[model samples]
Target: MTMDTAIARPELLLVADAVAREKQIDREEVLEAMEQAIQKAGRAKYGHEKDIRATIDRKTGDVRLSRWTEAVETVENEETQIPIHIARKFKPDIEVGGHLVDPLPPIDFGRIAAQTAKQVIVQRVREYERKRQYDEYKDRVGEIITGVVKRTEYGNLMVDLGRSEALLRRDETIPRENLHNGDRVRAFIYDVREEPRGPQIFLSRTHPGFLAKLFAQEVPEIYEGIIEIKAVARDPGSRAKMAVISRDSSIDPVGACVGMRGSRVQAVVAELQGEKIDIIPWSPNPATFVVNALAPAEVSKVVLDEEAGKVEVVVPDTQLSLAIGRRGQNVRLASQLTRWDIDILTEAEESERRQEEFRRRSGLFVEALDVDDVIAGLLVTEGFEGVEDLAATPVEELAAIEGFDEGIAAELQRRAEVALERKATELEDKRRALGVADDLAGLEGLSPAMLVALGEKGVKTLDDLADLASDELIEIVGADAMDEDAANAIIMAARAHWFEGEEDAG
Candidate 1:
């Protein structure tokens, strides 16, 4: 429509209504945009320094343009403000903060003015649309959305989500899954970001959440919350593992997810481009859950190191390849699903390792306590890990061992204490040789062995220890030596002198 027709005719409101409907924005916003466009043109017709404003009659579509000059005690600019004495001539009751408004006749728009107005309206509408898109989709993150592929740029898919467009980056798409323009696709809304250019909606097909959402859509029990998907891990387009639990005991989680003849799972697999899925039962027990995660392979034994957050799984030799999968894919996905680091070993390998450990610990007891092989083997078999364990054991408890008498237990304890003292003395000598400070040795949590370890790492003084972070201290010593809290305590103790000096200075 021409600018004159747009401003003067009743068709302006109709055009605004149509634009609002088409752009999916509020009708009032379109009217405001039109008002801004008119205001821009009004300033061009009048002086640019004048305070011009424009408003549309929402009901009649009539446009009003006016210059607003504030009634001030003293005029700052002749173009935009008037003195109260002069303003009183136009409005007898005008207040100091009130405006003296003068209505202006509509201007005949030239080609350039019309283009500038159009540009303003277009820019305003785009900004509103972007804001609306951001507000609508920001809360929809982690939801499954379907859209048609609008175009591709640099291997990234620009998807048209009806009212808004979303981006599916190349890495987010399943490997080798080809999508073309105008093709319909489903993806998970991973993020919605407000960027300088516009609101960015990021989509992903390979996200583990995508797989979980797909399963929720396909599985009736999961949708109704009878069965909950605990975790999901994906090697997109190749394989995935989902751990599920059922609140209703009668309904089997794995069997329900699989469906009759695998219909339910097949639907999700089809959407994922034939990625094989293993639906495993979830358990509260970490060992049980880990065993369930490694499906199609029997776990002979599981040794968990809770402090280390690692699990060693012993499987029969025949099940090793299956448990590990091709190129470790099965175990890798299992690890992701369980949130644990897994070390897999064959039955024979685990047996050999256990035997070797038994020999080593037996030899340690034999040498440290000056005991015979039989006695050392008994000590190792009874779970005495070190000379410290022997020294710390009560005489009554030590005598309670099958082969031990009270006299033998007492002698063993004395010998254990002597061995620990000798080890400490050796470590103290090493610590002194490495120049670790005496005050550092006085720290409560640190043993002489740890002091030597710190000295070897060049943390030889209170200042050096104070400067070390807890993680660095843990690393310098050993994870088994102390945990984060103990490390922090020692570091704080090392820093005590600094506070004392500050107090003295004060």
Candidate 2:
């Protein structure tokens, strides 16, 4: 090639513009990459250790190759640096810490030099493309996208998402939804992560947000911010429940989501392969919300245990199966939507349980307090559960019960306290015989009776108590004896001795 042809190739600028437009990156970056590739090829022609640099004009694509050297006070390397005495001959005013540029002849494209340039260009372009993919998709997480199934490996589907490929793992697909190559699919962008191989975009059709997004597209109220999706739970292709509330009192959120004649909901259902959707109105009160979630089956009563995070729902006998759904799906979705554990039962079952609990508490009161059946029944009806509650109650509160005078209340309390004291004395004797450590009794949360119970359960030492987890402690004692928090506190107190030993060792 002639020197003029080698120096400035205008066609190179056209190639750079096309590559930049196709790769969706800056044209300046592609020009820089091309300069580096040409510089490497130039280095292969010249000495590799020399600082050979190449530059391309942005406007004209004029290429220039040069070798750079620093003018130092002391002569170091003869190839790149020159002494000031020698540099002054060329510049006539050379100074230390200044750079000198020496022009080099244009490289003749040998086979190996051309191959090296091609490799550098390809590598740099691929890096830029991967980075572009990462930057573009990172902020698009939680968005819904459409794609075509490119191929399947095992059960994973590689989808062509226009700009890049995305992964739809087998477990993230809707259940029993058989997708083939070239099939169009819509999925939610759950995650965008950069891996060693490349930027991975993970899509999911079974994500609960997928249903919410579909609703947002179909329901104008949701898109307009008049209605909000409170929560969503999906059993994927079988059934799904969504809770929605309206910011405006004038609009019915559930009705708006259902659309006119169920057109909006039907659209979502068609996309989900006929997954049943229940649009329920959201309520701040968990009990009311749970009642709404277990719809199509009437709830007769809902008893909530807030501390335990459980709700008991009572339905009619005929509606039990419907309330629980096929294979317990309805109740499971209700529990997830309400963020509470649900126990469903028929009205008859609840009534029978109530009677059994009444009889059990009545029998215990009668035997422990030496009271008659009528007095025991009265105490149980007044909602007193145990001897401890009776003994702890004030005389006035006890007398407030129907058919009980102040004198009878005082007598009942005295008897309850005496029985409890005798029981404590006997338990103390047993605790001593079991070799329970005395330090465990000093724990703040443990009462004398609770300590005795722990002794019986073989939690003898402080280490023993500390070694047991909170759940294990709660199990050793009755569920009503303590909550998980109190159990954790007691165990921590027992573990304090370990910290003291650690400090001593330190």
Candidate 3:
């Protein structure tokens, strides 16, 4: 032991006490920090600061700094050693070669040693803070975080998320809402991920998957794995469609996501800034899927065209608006939900489409024809709802209606003359549309062109129209003109067509 070891001992302990009192930490932490820092400083100085030794007592929380050397047979280096007999003077139990603990006298640390201590302390603190940050966010993934909007830089949203700021990109922001500095809002934490800039917080408003994620948070069944969200399709704020399957079967997936009385869905909708959500059941069958997709709007029939990724859903004429939604949102979402192109129509539109189809199918109207709505409606009002009706009916009979006139009769005659041709043309168009093939097979799709072809072929009589064989017609008229398909289409269109004369007379 040496007198120099005693000098600095009191001062080192005093620093430890002072730091503990100021930082309100356990005394051992401050002493341990000092011991580590002083050792690092001594290492940096090489032999220059050989007397600077530091120790922290684990039991008493005491800190001490001193200089000493072992009593070795021979001193390898003077900086860390002492003569063997010199170490034995401090203790009777100490042999000549045994180590001795010596105290260093109080002395001002040089500029370099002080700087080294400071660097080590700073590095330790930084490492501690790093671990603290990692622990803080690691458990916060997939949770909602409330943050105040900080600033906007080139449409990028900067939000102060308590301990750190999160960057919400332009695409992640809600479509109609603009974030201003100091706006308070909540966002879902898509992920807590390490990035070059540190933890990157991803926010989303338009993501289709976001809907399901949101429900999983709010719905107990979903969180417990009782309900599974099958798929989601969104139009951002205005509309979104989702498909859900109940794992339990007993628990309703749609109702569960929608909440008891909509409280659950309202929470999600509020977070989405008023986005509309339709929770529909998922079906493996294409027909069933199409029906499910047109939610909040009842579907009577679903005609599938799976090969073309298309489907036609039929609804009553009155539900036309609801089925299509505002600017066709319902059908659009349905298309997104079912992954199929959907064509929507009112009964009237379907009827009009049927007429076009029949014209093609019946070999009636060939091309370049537009039927005015008024005439069509008039004919529709008069039981001549389709071209096939006019094709089989006598021109004079159609003229017998209230607005009857020779000119009107001739017009009816012309229309009926082209019925089958129009129907056949319409059917071909519908066929290319890749919807249901049978959708055009109904008798209501007749065109006037078919009627003319029929009259020319001596099939104008009512008895003839009734007895017409579509297959025989196809054989006689050639596949390109009037094939069996054309004959059958003509008969179907005429039967399906509403005769204005008959309807008016009735």
The TM-score leader among the candidates is 1
TM-score of 2: 0.90
Candidate 3 residue-pair clash tally: 68
Cα lDDT tens digits for candidate 1, 431-500: 9999998988988988888998999899999999999999999998998889999999999999999889
* Alpha-carbon runs more than 4 Å astray in model 3: 1-40, 47-116, 150-155, 180-183, 205-210, 213-225, 248-251, 259-261, 296-332, 335-506
C-alpha TM-scores of all predictions: 0.93, 0.90, 0.48
TM for candidate 1 is 0.93
In candidate 2, position 79 carries an lDDT of 76
Q: After superposition, how far is residue 392 of candidate 2 from its true place, in Å?
A: 2.1
Q: Which one wins by lDDT: 1 or 3?
A: 1
**Candidate 2 regions off by >4 Å?**
1-6, 47-50, 68-100, 466-506
The Cα error of candidate 2 at residue 364, in Å, is: 1.8
Tens digit of lDDT per residue, candidate 2, span 194-259? 987889999999999999999999888899999999999999999999999999999999899998
Pairs of colliding residues, candidate 2: none
Candidate 2, overall lDDT?
Answer: 0.91
